[model samples]
Target: MSNPLRLVLFDVDGTLVDSQGSIVSAMTASFSALSLDAPSRDAILSIVGLSLPQAMQNLAPQQSVANQTRLVDEYKQAYHAQRLAQGAASSPLYPGARDVLEELHAQPETLLGVATGKSQRGLDALVEAHGLERFFITRQVADHHPSKPHPSMIQAALSETGVAEQHAVMIGDTRFDMDMAAAAGIASIGVSWGYHDVSALNSATAVIEDFAQLSPALAQLWDK
Candidate 1:
């Protein structure tokens, strides 16, 4: 019988890149453009894994859709501009992020994919800036699916890669990622260095402190 495929799906923002500084700056600029007070940093971090519209809603739950749409549009522009100006320094990879991804991609039995709340354009720029395109086969993005915690992105990734829920694991730093993976019936692992509260990632199979710890955790999951 053919071997079952093992897939590792990664989240972009907090898990792979430390883009929080830039994210907060862009958001501040976005709100500034509208002459509004931006949500606090903690509030922004809390919504880091959601799609922009959903995030805006969480930030201002009582606001009208048109208002949220305006925020979303302004935020996108501000983020794009910040990225362009920052160039390659926009978002550095988290410590050992490249090493882990490289190590896993080297394993022929393992397939790598990405499920992110980032827009396709944003995700593309991020991967390209870091030369990470070759490591991923299927990339599920907010531009292509509903916001995370909805499971559409993970579901689409699993279907596209022909990897069963049991054979796939999601790696991210947020509870949203965990909830999404759970909603899709896939196991998940969390990273500590992301913007979210790592303690809140109770749904993860394991919470890893570094990339070096990831391989072992993944092995443990596969064994279960």
Candidate 2:
């Protein structure tokens, strides 16, 4: 008999790709354009899994709503410009990311998806640049939902793939991802290399230090 379908949703930035350089550079440019001091790298990275607007709010709480909106626009423009200049190099996949993704894609019972804070255009660029367009069954982005820590994105992915909460899992590098999965009533696996500290992923069902450990983690998760 065939196994039940399973959904695995991933977070993009720190989880799959190492885009910290681009994120920080764009954030700096955005603040510079407004003649404002950019937040520290730690501050910026702390909000990596949240939507851009929410990120801006966290980074610039002292700014008026109008200024925060301007920062968001400026950051988008700067990030897009950098992406055009750097192409695939702008957000290169982490070591072994593609291989693990391919392995998961090869499983007939597994359906892959993305639940990220990135905009649709940003996600499309990454997928196209990396030739990953064929791997994802559902792409949920911040443009259509509330930011990380909210269940909207994962819920949308589940709805689209017809996967039950118990049969789905979220893999990310942040507490936001873990919290979101919990809110959605799905399991979560946190990666140690992402922006968030490993200690912050206390809610994760399992925390893996490398991509090679992912399959085993997934196996264990489903075995429960």
Candidate 3:
């Protein structure tokens, strides 16, 4: 196979799907199961891009490590149950996400990957549900790698896809994504439509307002 001109890694939650509702609801359920109050919506959103344990730790730093571990486990169970109750399609893809991915995937020189905080099981379900499994050739999830802001996920995707750090771009909605890209010595794009405020995306190489802007931005990045 010929070398890819670039590898594009995407974050699943705020970047592709509007999963705030499902996440908030699931976190609420997890807290309730422990007979504790759920964190506020803002608090939940703040940690959306981190792995479960990391997120739970930030949300309840006062809790014992044992309790934090329990919360993480409960959050998974509660999230799964909530997703089942809401039907398997609890979150919808952001408008134009499919089109943008389709267009990029068709570019023979570009490879697609996913570097997300979601577990592999969760990523599998999400991709299958959206029929987007075809677009990605590599997927790095929280189950197998350290959480965002860590370069493990990005580096793993680069290694698996045989794409050098210089030829990869990480697209996400949070500082975690940007920091990860920076740590991996790659570029990052932040989308404004996600849970995080635009100001938080200052670390990004580029911040796009919509999916339509992605193609042009990518083209510019590649040519630079």
Candidate 4:
């Protein structure tokens, strides 16, 4: 396992789990609570990787800042409440996600972790519910640092795992994820099965179709 990848940082939502329906439902509930128009499912799905504040900005740009704050607060509450009842049902992993992670975990030199916009509490719940807590050696949640496109979260994961930037790679389903990796001067692999399409992942060093492709992708990265 020498010369192996030191760290692999993952994005949670679209990359590992498909929580689109739950997200849209929660957004709708929040909008209803505020008497505002709920964004369409497709629209909500498009902003899956962003922080709640950022998502709110994209969904209701015309709304005043005060209103946006209020709406986002309501959205978080609704989402958390619904998640408590449904547990992992609302955010099931994509096919092969668990297997892929398990395979990655088998590598002695690789330290698996997450960099997500979800709050630490929310991320902990999801990981524990899905039995994924055992796989990650570290986790960088939203409140741990500034939002994505910022490298702080990734930086934190590297520092905690003792993995240098050059020895790490990021895997996610969005341009934001790729951008963040690029900003950190680390390689990134984008997945087509996530929220963003291929074109959106063009900036990534590699683009994979599914979890089965991840090992080969990492092999290629090592070759470089």
**Which predicted model would earn the best TM-score?**
2
- Writing each residue's lDDT as its tens digit, candidate 3 over 1-224 gives 66557999999899999999999988998888889989999999999989999999999999999999999988899878866676546888999999999999998999999999999888898888788878999999999888889999988888888888889999999989988999999999999999899999888999999999999999889878
Question: How well does candidate 1 score on lDDT at residue 122?
Answer: 94
Count clashing residue pairs per candidate: 0, 0, 0, 0
The TM-score measured for candidate 3 stands at: 0.96
Kindly indicate the candidate among 1 and 2 with the higher lDDT.
Answer: 2
RMSD of model 1, in Å?
1.1
| Model 1 spans with C-alpha error above 4 angstroms | 1-3
Worst 10 residues of 4 by lDDT: 1-10
| TM-score for each of the candidates | 0.97, 0.99, 0.96, 0.96
Tens-place lDDT per residue, model 4, 1-224, is 45744899999999999887778888999999989889888788888878888888999999999989998899889889989999999899999999999998998888999999888888999999899978999999887677787988888888888888888999999998999999998999999988877798888999999899999999889778
- Per-candidate Cα lDDT values, in order, are 0.91, 0.97, 0.90, 0.89
After the best TM-score superposition of candidate 2, give how far the Cα of residue 160 lies from its true spot, in angstroms. 0.4
Comparison by TM-score, 3 against 4, better one = 3
Candidate 1's displacement at residue 118, Å, is 0.4
